[model samples]
Target: MAPVISSLNPNHGPPTGGTAVTINGSGFTGVTSVKFGIVAVASFTLVSDSQITTTAPAGTGSVALTVTSPLGTSNGVTYTYSVGPVITGLSPASGSTSGGNTVTISGSGFTGASSVHFGTASASFTVVSDTQITATAPGGTGSVPVTVTTSVATSSNVTYTYVNSTAPVITGLNPNQGPTSGGNTVTISGTGLSGTSSVLFGSHSATITAITSTQITVTAPGGAAQPVSVTVTTSAGTSNALPYFYITAPTIAGLIPTTGPGGGGNAVTIFGSSLALTSAVHFGSAAATNITVNSDSQITATAPPNVGTVLVTATTPGGTSTVGLGDAYYIYVAAPVINSLIPATGSVSGGDDVLISGSNFTYIDAVFFGTAPASFAAVSDTQVVATSPAGAVGPVIVTVHSSGGTSNGATFQYQL
Candidate 1:
């Protein structure tokens, strides 16, 4: 099938030729030749299957332009040779009173434009081609007639209105802190952000995901672990900047009382840096509750009911703490219990080693011999060795304590 020529960018240029033009259409791949009215284009470059670029060849009056490919020859479009600069239209015919916004003036015969004037004031301008010139509106007030000047002739006048417009104002940024490795979405709340041209974090540009008159969402770029200025730019000007922080990922140096009961509800202190914004703490797949951040290096959260061993991690806006960086492992065990006491009796003067057998005694914290406390050693999950403390010659109730809870009471006798 033959390629198609939709339209030409300039349609017109100097009779002497050498005007840059972009051919827009479809099926442009493998284009073999191009011609400006049978004169044959000097050279042409195929940009894509839908576009082509080439210099307009020297021609007189109106001529047909076409592209040829191995499939077939394309239809021709009329291309004209310009005699002088002409102004057909202006984009954003209005700008701020203080000026400095780029305005595009579009028309044919723009080749060799020497200057652009807003009323009597000369404005800086760049000729993009025979059809477009971009001018930075000079400071002015009220409406002014803008015209383009070339050696051959001055283009027709077009009205450019000047009025004061407020620069954007930023009120806040949600989740303003994120991992230094970046790739986090941050929402910006502000005013006058319509038609925003760019959003910058510090000096780096962020990819805008969405935008509106009062809010914008952007994918943050990678940055250092420090504070940076976040700002937005639009036609009016750059907005007021808000502070953003780039934080490194949180770490877990250690988890105090690394083991607890499967029933849960125990305070566990997490120690590490970059934890000031900790939002969640997890033990295995279960989330902890009542999390309180003590500082940048510490947080306390009630362990949730979970069984077996699991990696404990703290998550913040900065990032989640990874395992292998610290003591991030936790185990859940059953409560220690005292099934029976050996000899069950000890001297009132206080030193007697007793054998305490029970279920779940692996993490015994302490043992009670009646009203007095006793020193104890856990030999296994179900046994403990304890020395009775001095007391009056009488019987006392004995118990065991562990991460689970206090165990059922067992009888222990004291004698004279």
Candidate 2:
């Protein structure tokens, strides 16, 4: 009961043989041969004992077939000879699905390979000889057809093609602005910005490392106070916000006088432009006897007394500039103490006619003996009528001209 071959006639032939096959079965007795693999079929004829009559030889496709019995052997079925699998080549037709692709498939029968498909994906093959086969491509979408499935009995339509590779695209982000405590180092152009997975300034996700394709280096995420929009993410999607901006540092706009004269020298002229960084120009709270930061919008302070209107500020690093225009400047009367003046002497070449009395010559505007040019004729605002044009006389200083001021010196005499 070891004989089974229910039909086989010209099923397919060609490997070097004419054709004339006929073999139906059911316990063929003592027939000792009929094999289409290992090639051998030169006109067989048993005719009964179940039946056997063949004529086909020459090999390439369709095999794993057998029939040789004395009472044993006849279980491998399939015999279609005429060669069919022939694909030519395929080594890296494109890949990405996280599939770790490593393809290499040449053509012709690929010996003993039972499966290797890339279209519906079921790959993991290896048959490196007889025409190469080293596959690992399973996660397809665009192009597919690199197949090789064999169980022997030959069957081939021959095919190999699979491609799907796309990863890159992002666009815009230059100064987008930021400041909520965020550091700010943003530059993200676009178009597949090289492997950048994240960089957002609006939703708050920054700290992206440097990457390129158009450039992407990010560090901005504190909470966003003003400027927004800036996004970039890759794997293939997300990029189109681009706008960053944030500014809040430079303020102090009103303080012209606010208060002056307390022993705090008093020359106060802080107009405000960050006041050029005036550290202490306080007058109502005390501490501004002398502070001079002349530019950035002027500051010449000298006033500290605990006054009635206090508030004139200027601080930098981008943070304080207050000048609310309160106004204060007045503490006069201490102008008239020309202590002593007797006879000192004067004479350089011009006749010395001198007599200067001192006390507090008010508002005087003309008198000089050392720099020569004194021809005063006032005498009654503390006295004056000085005529000493070319002077070099030792201790000489007599200046007095009135209107309620000018005369902190007097002592003259020159006769040569």
Candidate 3:
């Protein structure tokens, strides 16, 4: 009985055909030949009595495909060969020369596409469907014809354009210098800042906060002391580097005799590094009266009138010193006064506990009995208990000395 052919897998192929076709039919073993039209297939495999696989030779148009075994020739099945692929359109026909742009191609006969080209450059491509292909363009310049080549033929129906890349330009930076710890926002102005991929300070990368064609805002990254290059990168290219300075914030290591009167007229010497460019000195919220940048390590500033303990800060172009780090402090006190004295008279033997009453005596450093130093204990903010020293039989004045200033003398009589 003659073999009966039912179907052929992939009934169509390119005209320059090398397509593998699977024949499904009722066929016995010992298949002698498989033919497409009058041409014979050079390579074929008989998997079973009901299936045969064969390679189609180069041909064009539709033709009768048949299998002939020792028993009888199989009934003919039809197979058609396709023409070349045709590209109709290209999405994003223009891109930067730096390349890495995805272009979508819409066309017909795109199935089994072998190669895609942009001018003389070969592009990596993927066939999405019979009518679509997505390609990643290679680096190129100027306009180029894009083509898709199949086994049968190649089609050139679209043009891809390569535009000259524009490098980013930096015009200026706001608050150029910052603390080494770095979390300050810096506004960078320039051209071609749009689509920025990276913002780098020195070798560190900054976090981008906002971006525009002419401006970009980014948070600075921590860096060492010195100047570093700041640059922006986009798809086009890297921009010219701008200088960014990483400065250590001014520090106040010591304040000479860190206490003063509430009237605030004392010149306090500030000792620290990074003080050369001192712009402002602050005592709490009050600005200093006179600020002198004595050197990079020292500053002389007049303490502003303030009360209690206040933080002192030195400011420069880099940044201001942080408050409450110790060392940088000034305690403002009300000047001590001589209100009265208990036991105003004492024996010349110099053994007497005199209770001195006054305001602003909390920090008393010394007590004097008629120009002689005496032992004293600060009883409170307004009182000091002092031992009167030996003196000649006469009227002696007792006084207290504190950071607030020396108190007025109170008359004390000493008996000979």
Which residue pairs show collisions in model 3? none
Find the candidate with the highest TM-score and give its number.
Answer: 1
Could you tell which candidate, 2 or 3, scores higher by lDDT? Answer: 3
- lDDT on C-alpha atoms for all candidate structures: 0.88, 0.60, 0.87
Model 2 — which ten-residue stretch has the worst lDDT? Answer: 328-337
Deviation in angstroms for 227 in model 1? 2.2
Candidate 1, residue 115: how far the Cα is off, in Å: 9.6
Residue-by-residue lDDT tens digits, candidate 3, 287-389:
9977888899988988878898988888875678985455887899777897999989999999899999878887788899989999988889888888999
What TM-score should be assigned to candidate 2? 0.23
The positional error of residue 311 in candidate 2, measured at the CA in angstroms, is 69
Q: State which candidate, 1 or 2, has the greater TM-score.
A: 1
Each model's TM-score? 0.61, 0.23, 0.59
Q: 85-200, model 1: which lDDT tens digit per residue?
A: 77989888887888899999999878778889999999999999889999999999999999998754577799999877889999999987888888999999989887787899
Which candidate number has the best lDDT? Answer: 1
The model with the greater TM-score, 1 or 3, is 1
RMSD of each: 12.9, 19.8, 8.6
